[model samples]
Target: MPDERTHARAQIRGVKETAEADLLAKKNVIGVDIADKVTDGKNTGQLSIVVFVEDKQPTSKLSAADRVPKEIDGVPTDVQQMTVELQGPSMQLVDDVTPQVDTTTYAVLHGGISMGPLRSVYLTPPDVTSAGYYIFAGTLGAMVRDRGNGATMALTNFHVACVNSTWSVGDRMVQPSLLDGGSSSNQFGSLTRATLSDDVDGSVVTVDTGRSTTPSVQDIGDVAGHTAATVGAAVRKRGRTTELTYGTVISTDFTVTINYGSDVGSRTLHHQIRVQTDTSRSARFSDHGDSGSVVMDNNRMVVGLLFAGSSDGQWTFANPIQSVLDELNVDLMVAPVVTRPIVSCLNTRLVVCNITRPVACLFTRSAGCNLTRTASCLVTRAVACNVTRATWCPVVTRTAVTCSVFTRAGCDIPIPDPGPIEGGQSEDGHGYGATADVPEEYWAGYLAALEEINELDGPDEA
Candidate 1:
């Protein structure tokens, strides 16, 4: 969200203005305290009437008056009467989630994402009961291309798509409002499961509007024509709610954590990210309403999608553009590709794994091989080690680059099954047969890497 100075200040002014509007919208009744006859002493049987302004402020101008109210408090109401504040506006959230926004940043993104050059569409799990209504305002670094028929698919965070639930196949998606355009891109898109991977979040009854795609601020001192940036390169993001911001990919060892879904809340992807950015844009990057902002590189190649970030932008993380490609398996490459690292076990000399490579993560062992490469690495009290083959599966974004182990059960944390009519099961990478679960194209890459590492005996001495 934007800074309180700018956004909040403006909002405060606006809220006050609105409250002043409703200042006279006061209605009172001759009511009695229909309590269980409790004793606050004085009015055990009678209740006091009150008057209030309906906005962010809580205290109403009229306290629990012994008499009924005389006016319908609203804008026409006098300032003195408007000050007749009441308890309500500053109450708990009523719907989705509270959009913690900096008014200025909201103004920015509200212009762009809600009204950018070409409106971007996002696919989220639909409310089947609502006839598959889409979750508007999603972010995407890349989209998916189906291997089955080479169809294009939307790629975004699993949580953004409502993973771990029984969503009807081919559900619809909705885009958010931005800029001057309200319901501008009111088009709906269809989605089939290309891939889904989400972690757990704590037990919350429902997702807030904030969790989906809220707002934040960033201040990119106008780059000429928005010439984009690249990996190992610095970039800036201009958000709808946030102004402009900068950040470094400290690590993409993307491990998100979840507390609710593993059991009680019974769903995954209710989590947050840890980002790393400089102090200039660090104070604020993105917030609640800025969820679907596309993070452009210096080159503006859309390196990452700005979904979540800290209030104070100290450290930040992003779902890599490459990872999005791998997840949905698509290509948005307008720039030449650079070679990535190779992971191997120094101790076992086994060809190690790359978690976010968007390709084969684990490779078979090469006898006598002693080196490995992984884009993500972490040095705990113990030495920095390969994340894939560790005993514990280190969460990618939420937990940072921690050691992760491979066990069928380890990755297969139970998510609730779909309701009776919506029958489908999440994949569990099991033993040999599980290998079949690997797509042919994905397996081909793995086989090539494995053969190279293991030096599989070729047809010899024929």
Candidate 2:
């Protein structure tokens, strides 16, 4: 059964489909879509068909035919004023000013870094032909694997990678971008696929051999996978100019018209995800040069491919990640998830054991090493413990077992006095002292084991 949000979204989509053409034809209207209803600049927790306009005006100043209705097919209509444009640098005349350079270089290419066509066309703007040219670049959104050949590729917006309609396959792609001081020597890949449609504005570049690429996003870690964008969900992006920023999914299944300059002209995109800056974490979600950044949820799952935004940077738009992936026929190149084995012990005094080698247990006296039988043990010690696999020890009583003169057959090792176990006392006055002093690498496992022991064993007792 569809939940409340899903049902509401379906209803809004229906109303939008029926009313979109008519709404776009209205005066000052730039786009239309479904979004959370806003009243007096605050969201009202209600879904509505949003009418995007270049400027908001009072009904008294508008003609009756141009005025937007309050409701469409029983759904509320929200008239929002914002100027939306493709979030990429268009052809512009650069006289003598030096472009700001991003000096960071990546040996292994990944997402969330500057990239673009190997060379931006040097165009002579009409009437001014004094050595002026256009240098363009945008964020490399992600790394993907081609479905047909399993070859690695870099993902970015078509406008960022293609530059113009004259672009062809095998065109060289560069890192850091020409605008960011990247030269022809910095070429890393070549454009293999691209699409500019109502659903996506994405492209993929075949990464060159000998050049390594990871699935991780800069500053955001690895992307586990991709998921559908959910309204009101928190999302983030690491882009070329913005680096890392937070936002909220204010709307989905959005249809917006963006001007891609003269090269591509104005194209209307459908089924886009609209995001608004999460003011608590950032003032803006994206900006020029941030195009092609992948928007991911809190769990680091890709949700959208950022492509467009408002001129003021408050509102941003993205193509759903699934749409982009489908269009390119590629899958996200993600790292495998690693699961660690759990180590547990019963006695109050924690024992550091090297499971990889022969059974050799070392006991040390340190605070915070309280763990019970059946509880996972992870403790920090000065000495490193080689624990590749989990080892289970039988439940033992709380008796002081000194290791001053202890030895085991076939195991020749020196025994150090762990001193007296102290501090862990019960009401019965009979309890064992918990020892801490595990290697730093194993500290996380030990802490988890201690928590489990405390929960299962409750209070320390004789």
Q: Which candidate is the best by TM-score?
A: 2
Query: TM-score for all predictions?
Result: 0.33, 0.74
| Backbone clash pairs in model 1 (N, Cα, C under 3 Å; residues 3+ apart or in different chains), count | 90
Tell me how far the alpha carbon of residue 36 in candidate 2 is from the true structure, in angstroms, after superposition: 3.7
Error of 2 at 47 (Å): 2.9
Alpha-carbon shift of residue 27 in model 1 (angstroms): 52
Q: List runs of model 1 lying over 4 Å from the truth.
A: 1-136, 140-152, 163-166, 177-185, 198-232, 238-240, 254-256, 259-274, 292-294, 305-312, 333-462
In order of listing, the candidates' clash counts read 90, 14
Worst 10 residues of 2 by lDDT: 373-382
lDDT of 2 at 88: 77
lDDT of every predicted structure (CA atoms): 0.33, 0.76
Candidate 1, residue 86: the lDDT equals 9
lDDT by residue (1-462, candidate 2, tens digit) is 339878878867877988998988888999897877899999997878889999999999999989999998799999999898778743334444244434466888998998878665654433124445666778899999999999999999998888768789999988878777677889999999999998999999999999988999999999899999988899999998878999999788788887765656778888889898988999889888889999999999999999989989888999999999999999999879999656433334443332111112354433444422111121221122222223332223233422232233444444455443212222334222322332333434544665564465453322
